[model samples]
Target: MKKIISWAIIIYVLYCIGMAWYLFSFADSSIPAEWKGTTADPATFLTPREQVLSEQYSQWKNFLFFVSVPYDWLAYLAVLWLGVAKALQTWSEKATKSFVVQAAFYVFWLSIIMSVLTLPFDFISYRISRAYGVSTQSVFSWMRDETTDFLVNTVMLFLLVVVLYGLIRRFEKRWWLYAWMVSVPFTIFFMFIQPVVIDPLYNNFYPLKDKVLEAKILALAEKADIPSDHVFEVNMSEKTNALNAYVTGIGSHARIVLWDTTLQRLQEKEVLFIMAHEMGHYVMKHVYWGVASYIVLTFAGLFVAGRVMNWLIRRWGEYFHLHKISALASLPLFLLVISVLNFSVSPVVNMVSRYEEHAADEYAIKLTKDADAAISSFQKLTKEGLNQVNPPIIVKIFRYTHPSILERIVFLERIKRGD
Candidate 1:
């Protein structure tokens, strides 16, 4: 078991190094020739005030993001090494009757502690956003949202842990496969219910009230063969000054959602471009594809986690006061493996996401024949969201789920030129 884990760790480390090599070796620096006479630098297109704000916002988020990676690793490690998980398991065993109920209690306790540990980072992020004029949410309102989020996450985590541990106990060898099978339907159920059952808890949503705008958006949706019945507007301005729109949910619950801030801030043409892009998401079945990709990754991740977990239990189980891989006390170790696996595969996952975004951009341009609108909309989003146009290559590859604004703009110009 020690030998197997050693090999796995070596291979995983090598894969990450290879990805880093590829990322750095091919770091992009080119911009379109047309950009030379105009604003060559994406930030220059913003107002002087906006440029300063964009840099500050981008730097703060990037620093927080990178810092949190190591912080999360240490937090999970602390819970395991400090016997926090063991303590929770002991308490749950004494406090509960049903094994499943005990699992729930353990999950709740661990989740609450982890949330508290991460609150300082979250609070700092909120304050930074507020300072930069992005977040409009008050600290009290943010805390309320965080509390609601915590409860929802705890319930979901409790259910997942109970099911996973049950599988580990019963199947022993093939539990990873069973867990992956269960996740498919579980994920679908959440996607179907989120818009109706969960989202409204955080913010208000209603059918878009603008008849003229609704008519235009519905026309675009029809062209993409997406549902044209209703476009939902979320009251996001109360929480954020950032402008955006997206497609969410699945099947009957599937709907287009516009941040109210987007409508208030962007032009009608820009809004149409944004709507078209989101409709492209539905038409292209990006959500289903995303889910499929996630399931595949989760299958591999769980398999690796199971393998590494067994080795770890054999190697240091007694030292950590962990009895078995299936024991509730092993939850922290399970999380640590999963986190490492997730971080290792993030660049690949993010590449797929960026591809989807680029495809959607193309679809929007092709459908609207409004390349000008699309380009301007990208610029508007860059300024409004305070996005970095050309963030550091390492940061872009690891952290960005969508292509940088500069990349999108250059791509758009190429498409416009038929290049």
Candidate 2:
């Protein structure tokens, strides 16, 4: 029975991988030209100086996309973890017999090494952003932010590993089930705390502080039926020239946050349009839906990983110095499997996200009744952010969380025409 179940899982994994490839290779990039009717082309919308910078930024981003898998999956996680696991095992051998303590120790060392290994890529990306006039932070400030991120992630990684390994030891066959169950609350807790706790570590967030604009936003929030006590402005201009506004957290924690750069770059109407879009996300319950989707994906990935890890350990246990799936040393192998599975599903996951974003765009237009503001906002953001208006289908399917700016503007124009 166990053999049959394992084989069935292997087949399902192969099927999912194949489906992912098909989605990436064959997804359509072009929407109906009717939707794009009479809208200004984003490709040629920028000033000459801005165009040059935009091209450079796009090229840098494209380069990063190509190397992401190799750097993150191959070098940082797989190959690094192989040797790191053995070294950690040696270090932890005499230090403790408690599994949770030993797992935490291994996680701490792995987190540090992973951060170091990935720092060069991160540095280069920051340099490119600065060269293109997108980033405003000094090197010292950037390093400080990076250090904070590393520490936060390290602590989270330690807790997760301890709980994960504990589950593995307690229930050999059903560890994945227990882990998935815990992740429901675990994920929500992070979401709930992120606005109040994690965000302040990097940037200061203050009430919008513009009385007239705040009143306008509050009015719009009332129209949308969302909470309106406060809208936040993040100190993003201190770090980047990009424009953004988002709604995050849940219940009392949920509120609007706009980047200071957004305030500087966009007009009042445009900012209101952006806020309306965020309100769309809130009213539509994208946050809750996103969490539910995560739970489903996490459950599926964990189940598959659990099944395959058992078989993998049997075959290559001694070679990797892993005696069992529950062993701390086996973490790298399990991570490698889960990473591959997650990458495979990225296109499908992103497809759903794009749909939600499109829905938000439609909702914003409906609620605001200001098609012009919505169109202007998308164009300004596309130009300022160096967005590729017409990227290849594969890139859109695999990478885009929002619909392309061109697609969005086109859609709003259609709505304007009563299409």
Candidate 3:
């Protein structure tokens, strides 16, 4: 039994190492050649607009240096892992209950510690938004929002981990099915609570103010055959400089949340264009596809984690101070798995999202007949949000969800020229 367990542990460790190496190698190899130019390159092909966005990225990078406090806090979880391992090694074989209790306690303790670490970045991000005149939330308001987020996330995390651990132990071979079943309820719970419970905690929402705009939007919905009531505006300007719009919720509760900043900053035609874009996501069923993809990826991650954990527990369980099951120790491994999956498959995800966005852009043009407005809207939003105007192809593949501003502008230009 001991030999079998030892070999399982060895094989699992090697698998993890190999997986990590493959991910890193792919990322390195995939970096686009265009982004390799030095910061000092004067002859760079960056347009004046691109130069300005790049400068903002530089400033944000500097601000990020002060944000290392959170990373340090996350590191403490590893330290806790070591401590738990020591404790488990010293425990008697007969004390299984005590071992499990200790392991659970450590998981909870690390979770609390990581949450505290995350607070600084959360506060800093909000502060920067406020400083930039993008957000209107006061420190007190920010704290309230953070507390609510923490509570919601904590509940979700606990439920997910508890169910996941049980699935791994009881139905190791059928863990994927168990996980998919769990996600059904989880998805329903999120859908029910997000609009009602979660979103209202951060921003104010009111029925769309302009009757003409509301009618136009509703008319467009009718044309698209999407059953939705009045369009809604979210006071998103109170939170960040970022400009975004989305269609969320289902049935009667379903409504579009247009950011106040987007409305104020963009022309009426431009705003409609943005709405058309969001509607395209719904029309194309991109959201459903995304959710399905996540379900499959999550199951894959759990299967890998189970195999790895079983091997680790059998061989080094005693040596590492892990008695029953240590969710905390397994977390880093789980994250690594998810990260690799996301990075490797990012191009496919981006391509799908970009396709939906393009469809929306086309829809907007069709409705408004203002391709010029669409182009200007893209430029203004990108500038205001400090988005890269001309990121390299490599960056687009790995990082960007939507196509670059230049690409969109060119596409619209072609549409205009054809007319």
Q: Which candidate achieves the best lDDT against the true structure?
A: 1
Estimate every model's Cα lDDT from 0 to 1: 0.83, 0.77, 0.62
**Candidate 1 lDDT for residue 27:** 44
Ranking by TM-score: 1, 2, 3
TM-scores of all candidate predictions against the true structure: 0.90, 0.88, 0.74
For candidate 2, list the clashing residue pairs, or say none: none
lDDT string for model 3 (1-419, tens) is: 34644564566556545534443343222113443442212123446655554545524433343234224423443433445424433342234555345444544554565667566766677666566554677788788887787677666666665676667667757765787788876875676467877788678888787788778878877777776563678887765667889877654556678888888888877887888877776676666666667677667766665666567667656544454443445544444344455566778878877877777777767867888778778867766775555554555675567877767876886787794
After TM-score superposition, what is the CA distance of residue 174 in candidate 2 from its true location, in Å? Answer: 0.8
Higher-scoring candidate on lDDT, 1 or 2? 1
Runs of candidate 2 exceeding 4 Å displacement: 1-38, 76-82
How many clashing residue pairs appear in each of the predictions shown? 0, 0, 3
The pairs that clash in candidate 3 are 85-320, 85-321, 277-360
Per-residue C-alpha lDDT of model 2 across residues 64-95, encoded as one tens digit per residue: 65555544655433432255677786687669
Pairwise TM-score winner, candidates 2 and 3: 2
RMSD values, in order shown? 4.9, 6.0, 7.8
By TM-score, the best candidate is 1
Clash tally for model 2: 0
**lDDT (Cα) of model 1:** 0.83
Error of 2 at 403 (Å): 0.3
